[model samples]
Target chain A: MEEIQFWIGIVATMAFAVTGVLAIADRGVDIFGVLVLGLITAIGGGTIRDIILEIPPFWSENQIYVWLALAASVATFFAESFFTQPQIYRWMLYIDGFGAALFAIQGATKAWMMGFGLPVGPVILGVITAIGGGLIRDVLAGRKTLIMSHELYAIPVTLGCSVYVLILNFTPQYAIEGSAFCMLGIFAIRAAAIHWDLHVPKMFITKTR
Target chain B: MEEIQFWIGIVATMAFAVTGVLAIADRGVDIFGVLVLGLITAIGGGTIRDIILEIPPFWSENQIYVWLALAASVATFFAESFFTQPQIYRWMLYIDGFGAALFAIQGATKAWMMGFGLPVGPVILGVITAIGGGLIRDVLAGRKTLIMSHELYAIPVTLGCSVYVLILNFTPQYAIEGSAFCMLGIFAIRAAAIHWDLHVPKMFITKTR
Candidate 1:
C-alpha cells in the first residue's frame, strides 16, 4: 500500500510538472523560471497540505519527489513542441485529471488519518492538495486561476474528497478501495467536463458591481 | 510580552488588509472577492509561518485577527475615495513599511521561540512571514509580486531577520532589544526606499531570452 502511494505520488508530480510547463510555454519565461514554475506546481499542493497538517513537507523529507519533478520539468521544457497536437493536448488533460483525482483522494485520506475527522476540514484539505499547485502556477504565470475560472475544475475534486471522507467514516475497512473508487469518479467527471466544454453557470458567478 | 505581540500582529493585519484592498480596488473584483483578498493578505504570511513551524494557524486560534481584517477591508472599500490624496498614499506606504518591519521581527522571534534555531530556517521563516501575505495579494490581483519586481521590498525583511537570528544566537538576554533594533532597521530601509523610489539595479535582473 505504501509502495502504491509512493508511485502514485511520483506520477502525479510528473503530470503536474507537465501541466506547469504547458501553462508557461508561450509566456516568454526563461528556462530557469520555467523550471522553478514546474517545481512549484508539482510540489506546491502537497507542501501546503503537509504544512497545514503540521508535518514536514513531503519533498523536504524525501529528495526523490524533488528530483523526479525537476527531471520531468526539464523533459517537458525541451519536448513541449511535440505535444502541440490537439490529440496530444486532450491526452494531457485526461492524464492531468487522473492525477488530480489521485491527489484529491490521497490528500483526504492523509487528513483523515491525521484525525481531522469526517467532512469539512478533510474535504477542503483534499481540494487544496489537488488544485493548490495549479492555482499557484496560474497565478505566477499571470493567468486566471482555476478557482477563478468558469471551468469545472474544483467541483470534481471537492466531490471526490467528500465521498472519500464519507466512505472512510462509514467503513474504515474499505479505505483503500474507497480511495480508488473516489479517484475514478473524480477523473470521470473531470474528463467529461473537458470533453463537453462544461463550465460553472453564470448565475453562480459573483459579478462586480 | 504576549500582549505586545498580539497588538503588533493586529496592527499589521489591519495594514495589510488595507494594502490588499488598495491592490484590488480598481481591478473589478466584487465585494466577496475583495474580502477574501483582504483576509488572505492580512493572515496569509502568519498562516504560512505557523504551518512551516508545525503550529496551528494564528487566525484559526484567534478570531480577533479575522474580524479586524474584515473590518479594515470593508472600511477600505467604502472609504477609499477619501484617501486619494498623495499625502494619504504616502502615509499608507509608511505605515505599511512599519507593519512589515514589525511582522518580520515578530515572525523571527516566534520561530526562535519555537526552537527553529539560529541562522537559516528562522531567518527564512521571518522573511516569508513578512512578505508572504503581500505576495499572495499581488499574485491574486494579477500584478507582479514584490520579490519579482525591482522594488527593495524583500531586502529589508531579509536583513532584519538575519540580524535578529544572529543576535539571538550570540546574546540570548538581548532578544527583545535585538528585535526592536531589527524592526527599526527594517522600517528605516523600507521607508528610505519608498521615499527615494529606490530599486534593484538592471545589472542584477535576469532577462528572458
Candidate 2:
C-alpha cells in the first residue's frame, strides 16, 4: 500500500509539472521561471494541505518530490514541441485529471489519518489539495482560476472526497478499496467534463449586478 | 502585552479587509465575492504561518477574527463612497503598513515560542505572515503579486524580522522592546515606499529575453 502511494505521488507530481510547463510555455518566461512554476504546480496543493493539517510539508520532509518535479519540468521544457500536437494536448488533460483524482484521494486519506472526524474537514481538504496548486499557478500567471469559472473541476474532487470520508468513517476494512473507487470516480467525471466541455448551470454562477 | 496583541490583530484584520474590498471594487464582483476576498486577505497570511509552524490556524481557534473581517468588508462595501477621497486612500495605505509590521513581529514571536531557534525560521515565518494573505488575495484576483515585483515590501519585513530574531536570541530580556523597535522600523520603511513610490533597482530584475 505504501509503495502504491509512493508511485502515485511521483506520477502525479510529474503530470502536474508538465501541466505547469505547458501553462507558461507561451508566456516567454525563462527556464528558471518555468521550473519555479512547475514546482509550485506540483507541490502547492499538498503543501497547503500539510500546513493546514499541522504536519510538516511533504516535500520538505522528502527531497525526492522536489527532484522529481524539477526533473519533469526541465524535461517538459525541452519537449515543448510535442505538446503542440493536438492529441498530446488531449493526453495532457487526461493526465491532469488523473493527477487531480490521485491527489484528492490522498488528501482525504491524510485528513482521516489525522483524526479529522468531521465530514467537512476531509471534503474541504480534498478539494483544496486537488485544485490549490493549479489555482496558485493561474494566479502567478495572471490567469483566471478554474474554480472561479463555471468549469466542472472542483465538484468531482469534492464528491470523491466526501464519499471517501463517509466510507472510512463507516467501514474501516473497506478504506483502501473505497479510496480506489473514489479516485476512479473522480477521474471519470473529470474526463467526461473535459471531453464534452461541461460546465455548471448559469444560475449557480454568482453575478456582480 | 496580550491586550496589545489583541487590539493589533483586530486593527490589522480590519485594515486588510478594507484593502481586499478596494481591490475588488472595480471588478464588478457580488457581495459574496467581496466578502470571500476580504476574509482571505485578512486571514490568509496567519493561516499559512500557523500551518507551516505545525500549529492550528489562529482564526479557526477564535471566531472573533472571522467576525471582524466580515464586519469590516460589509462596512467597506456600504461605505465605498468614503474611500473616494484621496486622504482616505492615503490613510488606508498607512494602516496597511502598520498592520503588516505588527503581523510580522507577532509571526516572529510565535516562531520563537514554538522553539524555532534558527534565525532563518522566524524570519521566514515573519515575512510570510506579513505578506502571505496579500499574495493569496492578488492570486485570487488575478493581480501580480507585490513580492514578485521590484516593490520594496517584503524586504522591510525580512529585515525587521531578522532583527527581532537576533535580539530574542542574544538578548532575551530586551525581546519586547526589540520587537516594538523592529515593528516601527518596518512600518517606517513601508510608509516611505508608499509615499515615494520607491522600488528596487532595475538591475536586479530578471528579463525574459
Which is the leading candidate under TM-score? 2
> Worst 10-residue stretch by lDDT in candidate 2 chain B?
B27-36
Native contacts kept, each candidate = 0.15, 0.24
Candidate 1 to native Cα RMSD, angstroms: 6.7
Off by over 4 Å in 1: A1-7, A60-64, A116-121, A166-174, B1-39, B52-54, B59-135, B144-209
Best by DockQ: 2
RMSD of each: 6.7, 6.6
User: Considering only N, C-alpha and C atoms within 3 Å, which residue pairs clash in candidate 2?
Assistant: none
The reply for model 2, stretches above 4 Å from the true place, is A1-4, A52-56, A60-64, A116-121, A147-149, A170-174, B1-39, B51-54, B59-135, B144-209
The local distance difference test score of each candidate is: 0.80, 0.83
Candidate 1 lDDT score at position A105: 87
Residue-level lDDT tens digits of model 1 in B1-209: 88876787788788888877787676555454566578878888988898778777766556688788989987777777654467886787788888899988888888888788556888988888888988887777676788787788898889999988989999989988998899999999999999999888788899969
True-structure lDDT of candidate 2:
0.83
